[model samples]
Target: MREYIESQLARGRGYFTKEEALAELGLSAEAFQAAIGRVKRKGLLVSPRRGFYLILRPEDRQLGAPDPSRWIDPLMKHLGLDYRISLLRAAAFHGSSHQAAMIFQVIAPKQLPKIAVGRQRVDFLFQTSATFEEANNPAWLSKLKTEAGFAQIAGLELTLLDICRYFHKAAGINGAAQAVHDLGKNANPRILAKAASAYENSAVRRLGYFLERFGHNRQAESLKDFAKKAKSFKALDPAVKPLVAELGLLDEKNPDWMLIINVPVELEA
Candidate 1:
């Protein structure tokens, strides 16, 4: 059983389901259960989630965790989820590596339970919008080369917009502002605008505020136009509660864009 599992892993498969193991190991019903139990006891395999077991190399057993990126594809495939890696993880892939990502953030079509791998956390944020469907091309998802194969990650522009759309889940407005400032110059304004359209008006307002502050004038203006058409005012960062008191003197508003600033944002000189 161990040799067979290792052979499959050697062939570049990162993980397997119980059924796959049963057929490949050529074990009788009673024997298959025993084989799995033995391998698991030896730490040769790990079930990151139910019904999914990852093949562990000898070194991996010592470390006690496989690289989540390596096995993420198979796990998602087993669960039947079409997920796109996003946020700081996507930012790193796109060239903004200032902040190390603590969580492996993913956008899934439906709700998914959180997954823990060693010290790393795989968080699945659900998107209910039908219009915000994952794109099938390279324009939307950048390929991440893994031991298994390339994993699909959100594109640079999409990552920037997502950082704003989910600013609260991200590193608040201040951290997000820094990330936007870092990624702004390299990203295409039109692509950013297109991505922003998929989100709510509040997200548009947040994107416009940051883009404008960071010198992406054309992009900021486009997002501002969208914000003007929106019906409500939104805070630049939603996580900072007691909004007005938090900003104090820094609190201000862009009436035209319908955004209430509740935090101080300064771009790098």
Candidate 2:
């Protein structure tokens, strides 16, 4: 079992499945389990998901496993799920590093629980198949080079929309604003408009508001038609409680984007 593992590592393959191990070692189920247990006890192997094992090299042994970006592509492929690195992580990759993400974030077609391997944590967010498919267009996604090859990640425009769409998870509205502010300098109005068309109107409205607030008037203007078409008003920050109603304060609305300002947005300098 150890020799097989060594050969796999030599070939630069850092992960394997239980079935592959059984086939390669020609061991009975009980024997295979015992052998795996022994290696795990030595801190040479760790499994983030059942049946899938990550082989830890000497350097990685301290972390208990390789970085998630190095192996996430293969892991997601093994699990038969289509995904992309998204939200704050993707935003950071696109030069919006004002707020570092504490956990890796992924967007998939279905809901999934957070994964913890060694010192790493991965949070999964869900999008409907249609929405995910639309946003996963090659134009909107990019290949992020990693040690293990590459992982799929959202482009700058998609990252902005995703941050607005999942503000609660990305950080609060202010964090989202900071990210928008940071990325605004390089933003393309047409591409931003194109990407916003793929998401829900609520997120588009919020994104437009942020773009305009941050002085990206051309980008903000590009989204005005789409925002105007939405018949209903959405809150600027969906996660915030309706303080205006509670305190009997006048409801503040941004007429151009048709968004209710339920909370004050202060961007990080």
Candidate 3:
């Protein structure tokens, strides 16, 4: 059975499940478990999560893994869930690499338990399936090939809106602003306005201000146009405390965009 498993892996298969092995090779449950234990001890197999295993190359045995990007699609498929790699991770995929993300962030229709792959972590943020269906568009997602297969990540426009909506999880306004500045050129004006409108007024304002800062006037104007009907102001970073007390900055706010300027920002052309 060990030789059989090795033969299958030698054919270029990089991953497998106990059920697949059992079904294909007709191994009894006890035999399957024993076979798995043996390969694991030999450093040929690693279980990143229960019921799934990655076939490790001899070199990878030292690190005890392959890239987690290779496992994301298979794991999500195993769980039967919809997901989008998002936030700063998405920014990196779209070519605005900021600080390398220590944790891979995923937005799935249902909350998935956290997973650890080698030294890296995969964290899932939950959103209703309904919301995911509504916001998910082909234009808003990109398919990039990974070590094992492909992973779907958010596109630049949607990533900008998402980072602002989940501002606390992303780098603060400064970081978000820098990403916007770096990736702003890749954003499609019409698509950006539409995506921003789908988010709350606060998200719109934050994106609008950042777009303007980076000289994306057309996209910024479109977001501002949509924001005119809004009735309230949202702090630039919702996670931040009031600046007047917390940081001694004046209680200055941008009336046009209805964003509280808790921290001062300077931008140049």
Give TM per candidate. Answer: 0.89, 0.94, 0.88
Runs of candidate 1 with Cα error greater than 4 angstroms are: 28-30, 129-131, 134-138, 243-251, 266-269
Per-residue alpha-carbon lDDT of candidate 2 for residues 13-65, written as tens digits (9 for 90 to 100): 88898888888889999999999999999888999888889999889877767
Model 1 C-alpha lDDT per residue in residues 1-269, reported as the tens digit of each score: 87878778778886888888777777787987788889888878778888788887766765576767787777788888777888878777777667567567888788888887555578888887474573323576787888788787888777877788776667667657877888877777777766776777787678777878778787677676687687776666556647566547335777867877767776345
> Is candidate 1 or 3 superior in lDDT?
3
Clashing pairs in 3: none
User: Each prediction's Cα lDDT score?
Assistant: 0.75, 0.85, 0.76
Q: Write the per-residue lDDT of candidate 3 for residues 11-103, one digit (tens) a residue.
A: 666787777777888989988888889978887888877888887777666667776677788778877877888887888787776735655
Question: Which numbered prediction scores highest in TM-score against the true structure?
Answer: 2
Off by over 4 Å in 2: none
What CA root-mean-square deviation does each model show from the true structure? 2.5, 1.7, 2.6
